[model samples]
Target: MKKPRNKFFQKNKFDQAMTGYLFLLPALVALLVFLIGPIFYAFYISFFRFSFLEPQNAKFIGFSNYIHLFQDKEFLRALWNTSLYTIVVVPIQTAIALFLALIVNNIRGKTFFRVAYYLPTVTSTVAVSVMFTFIFQPDGILNKFLENFGIHGPNYFNSPTFALPAIMMMAIWSSVGQFMIIYLAGLQDIPEEVYEAAELDGARGFRLLWHVTLPLLKRTTFLNVVMSMIGTFQVFDQAYVISGGNGGPLNSTLTVVLDIFRKGFKTMQMGYASAMAFVLFAIILIFTLIQNYFLGREDK
Candidate 1:
């Protein structure tokens, strides 16, 4: 009787496991088709001299695509531009977001301010890009405001010197809202008792914030930094829209992702584009790992 009951339980457990797998099968299949499959296909295609225009005429070119990428001046320029953009935008955006989160979280009408600040994140990116394009126009509101201050603003999108910085500013403005929400969430999770104790020790305002708040918010800061870095590295839309899709004014706003898009879709250099995409992927992966390692270690 005991043995029979044990066998029955084993059979029931096996059936439950099968049922769980069946329920998860659809999502697993979707991931394989949309994510895993495309990644593998791109990797395979990168080894060949492939072109969308002449797909049937592809030839296996080994690492020639990568070699050419290294030799290409435009690719190098794109890399430099992307690196600079990531460095500048990530810190600025993170700092602004953290500052906004700190202020909003401590306020009475926190919810209203939170929603107001986060509105940009909910808005369409294209719409935001278009809005910023107009704002940065030589005759737009920004220049007019500057003029009122006895200052003249440059032609933001038309000048190679100022175009990339203008786009970076726009990116920071558009992105900080979402990160502020993240930081706000993190801030809320910190125990109020910690701040109360700090206050009892005569710590107040900036001192309390520095020793108590910032230290406790390290994990959130790490996350925000990594996310902002990754996002800035892949920035394309603002540059594309502002530069009129040519990454123009001497390719000043040409990001690596934009270059890859232009090479793949616009010029039909599928293999070369695949190589570029993989390189960008590698860069993101490296930075993410570095961030995780250092930040995680510091947390410990």
Candidate 2:
């Protein structure tokens, strides 16, 4: 009788598993239909030559899209601009966030400062971009302040040399608050006992940070670096709004995503744009993997 009851329980467990899978079927189908299906279809479309204006007339061109991408000077320039932006903004933003986190962690009014810093993160990107645009304008506050010191400020968005850097500066300002919040959370997770013990051993200030704080904040640093890099690489709003959607001056602010938008929508080269999208995706994936690998090795 006991053996029979166990057999019945095993059958019931199998039935419950089947029911759970059945319940998940619709969600799985939705994911495949909407996300996975579109990605694979885009991959297929990238190898061909198609125009959104005449999608029905698409022709198989055998990697001609990618070949054109390689030879396209404008695309190459966008790639270079994006690389420079990521290299500069990612490190600065991460460092600033980490520093802010450290300072806030030791303060008594943690809640007040955290909320104040995080206010920008919850603000609308478009509003912040427009605000920064005005602030960086030739006759705006920043320039006026510089003029008070007997210095002239260049037209930030109007000059080719300064356009990309202007966008980078705005990007850093807009995103740093959120990353600071993340780092703060990481810092709070460090056990109080570790610091207390370190203090007993004569560790203080910069030495405490270098030996104790940063060592334990490895995971947080990795997360912030990867997230910031990805965000900077896909930057669009600041460049688009500041440059008036032309990616100017002289296309100096044209990022990879901006190039993709121009090709996909303005030029109506959907297929070629898909290839650019895939390239950008691959670049992001490679960097993320590199970050994870190093972080994991450190853990081991």
Candidate 3:
């Protein structure tokens, strides 16, 4: 009787495991078909030289496409613009978001503040770009505000010098709110007892924040930094919209992703575009690994 009961239990566990896997099968298939499949296919196609329209004529050129990518001046400009955007936007946006999270978490009407700030995150990107374009026009609201201070504003989107900076400002405004919410979640997760223990040790307001709050929120900070960096690297829609899909104004806003899109779709150089995309993937991967090594060094 004991042996039969043991066999019955084993059969029950096996059946349950099978059921769980069955439920996961659809999602696994979707990932393979939609995400993983294209990734490998792109890598495979990157070695060839042909327009996507004429796949039958694709000639295997090995690493020549990637080699030419380095020699392409426009591609290099795009990389520079992307790197600049990531370096400038990521830190500023993260800092601002952390500040806002700290402020809102302690204040009355926290709900209202969170909702108001997070509105931009939910708003459409193209709409925001179009709105800001009008605001940055020479005679628009921003210029008018500057005029009151006796300073004339340049046409922001049309000027290579100011175009990327203008986009960066808008990017900060829109992206910060989402990271603020992430910080808010992290803040709420901290226990009140931690603060009490911190205060009892003679830590005052700023010191308590510096020692207790900041230290405890290191995980959240790492997450915000990584995600913000990745977002800046892939910034295409705003650059595309603001620069009129040409990445114009001297290519100051021509991000790597934007250049890849142009090469793949506009120029029909799908092989070269795929090469650029893989190179970008490798760059992002390297940055992520370096960050993991530094930021997650102490993690068990």
Candidate 4:
């Protein structure tokens, strides 16, 4: 019975799959020409000591770019900053989002809260960064509020100690809504019967949440973690705008992507920048794989 069914699908599906792929050809070509082509070109360029200004005189330098990348102090610092940002921001954002989702899921006027929370996620990042910059300024509303409590506010963007932390706070606030929506969708999809069973078993309050809701939401949590992790790792726009195009405040807000932009555009070291980008890609890939191992694994 199974062999006959398999033979029938094999006979019918091959032509259908080919036709589907034919329909996808335009998108595939666009992907290749615009995205994949540039990626491979950049990888090829990474082996040469190429510069935007002196492209005609580019020299083949083999693995020197990658070698020097590991030894470069500023690159190391940027790597560290990027890693720290991911570590601090992803978990906080995920937690805040999950909390907000739990609250909003059960509350009256949830529609209002949902719109309010999701507004920031839809807002432009540059605008958000600029707004936060003002908010974090010494004479801004945040500082003025602090002043009422007799607390002197620091120039957050200009202080190495507070610069990265300030960005982290903004990132958490701006991105949490998106993750919360994901959690909300996950919550909505959960079968009502599961809660009924848990209640019948006397699982109430935190116990019900711990034993029922959380276990069911593991996949949602994993999705949030992976996406947020990737976003945090690639953080550049806020750091660039906040730091005035240079990772200033004593290089405290320097991120990997921002540093790559500096090298590629400002310094015209396209080869070195390409190398840094590939390194960043590797870092992201490794972290994602680790997350998959822990969070995305199927239960026995």
- RMSD values, in order shown: 1.4, 1.8, 1.5, 3.8
Can you write out model 3's per-residue Cα lDDT over 1-300, one digit (the tens) per residue? Answer: 899999999999999999999999999999999999999999998999978799899999999999999999999999999999999999999999999999999999999999999999989999999999889998999999999999999999999999999999999998899999999999999999999988888999899989999988999998999999999999998999998789998888898999999999999999999999999998988998998898767775
> Cα lDDT of all candidates, in order?
0.91, 0.91, 0.93, 0.94
Instruction: Single out the weakest 10-residue window by summed lDDT for candidate 3.
Output: 291-300
Count of steric clashes across candidates, in order: 0, 0, 0, 0
- Give every collision pair in model 2: none
Cα distance off (Å), candidate 4, residue 81: 1.1
TM-score winner between candidates 1 and 2: 1
Top lDDT model: 4
Q: TM-score of model 2 relative to the true fold?
A: 0.94
TM-score winner, 1 or 4: 1
How does model 1 fare in lDDT?
Answer: 0.91
| lDDT tens readout by residue for model 4, 1-300 | 899999999978998999999999999999999999999999999999999788899999999999999899889999999989998999899999999999999999999999999999999999999999889998988999999999999999999999999999999999899999999999999999999999999999999999999999999998999999999999998999999988998899999999999999999999999999999999889988997887645654
User: For residue 269, what is the lDDT in candidate 1?
Assistant: 91
Clashes of 1: 0
By summed lDDT, which 10 consecutive residues of candidate 2 come out lowest? 237-246
